[model samples]
Each structure stands twice: as C-alpha cells, then as structure tokens.
Target: MGGRVLGYGTYHVLTHLTSTELYSHCELVRNKLVPLK
Candidate 1:
C-alpha cells in the first residue's frame, strides 16, 4: 500500500486505540513502525 493508505490505517488504528490490537498498533506507530498494511 501507499503512504496514504498506511497513514489512513494508522489514523484509524489510533482512533480505536482502546482495543488490544489497536493498543499494539499505537505502540507500533509510537516506535516509528514502517511498511504497515
């Protein structure tokens, strides 16, 4: 996916950070994860 897609996914994940998976996602973003899809 393109950066725009990754960005949107990140935003969606962050908005739902209450979920366990989303919490992990937040960590991934916080740690500067790349190649997210």
Candidate 2:
C-alpha cells in the first residue's frame, strides 16, 4: 500500500491504543506515525 494508506492504518491502530497493555506497540509507531492530517 502507499504511504498515505499506511499512515491511515497506523492512525487507526493508534485509536486502539487506549488499553495501557498496548502502549508498547503504540510507541513503536508513535515516532514515525503520521496521522490523517
């Protein structure tokens, strides 16, 4: 997929990062993540 699509997917994934248990996974992408801006 393209960068834009990948970014969207990452944003979607971030949305599910509310459960502290998943913070680690969120951190992995948080730095390189680009929201739907």
Candidate 3:
C-alpha cells in the first residue's frame, strides 16, 4: 500500500516537472521566434 502510494506520488511529480519544463521551453522558443512588443 505504501509502495503504491509512493509510486503514484512520484509519477505525478515527474509528470508535473516534465510539464513545467515543457511549458518553459515553449515559452523560450516563442520568445525567440516572436518579435517583442
């Protein structure tokens, strides 16, 4: 039970981190590709 809970939490954390990283990467690319105001 504990192991399952830990695994679930870890999976969610990794997913969140990956999503955050992806968003940041997209933002960076957009900033570089798009002109500033």
Going through the candidates in order, what is the number of backbone clashes in each? 0, 0, 0
Mark the regions of model 1 whose C-alpha exceeds 4 Å error after superposition.
18-37
- Which is the leading candidate under lDDT? 3
lDDT of 2 by residue, 1-37 (tens): 6999999999887777655547776876786676733
For candidate 3, what is the lDDT? 0.97
Q: Residue by residue across 1-37, what tens digits does model 3's lDDT show?
A: 9999999999999999999999999999999888864
Backbone clashes counted, model 2: 0
Q: Which RMSD does model 3 reach against the true structure?
A: 2.0
Candidates arranged by lDDT, highest first: 3, 1, 2
| Candidate 3 residue runs with Cα over 4 Å from true position | none
Models 1 onward score TM values of 0.43, 0.41, 0.90
| Candidate 1: worst-modelled 10 consecutive residues by lDDT | 28-37
Listed per candidate, the RMSD to the true structure in angstroms reads 14.4, 14.8, 2.0
What tens digits encode model 1's per-residue C-alpha lDDT throughout 1-37?
5999999999988777668777788888977855543
Q: Is candidate 2 or candidate 3 better by lDDT?
A: 3
- Model 3, residue pairs in steric clash: none
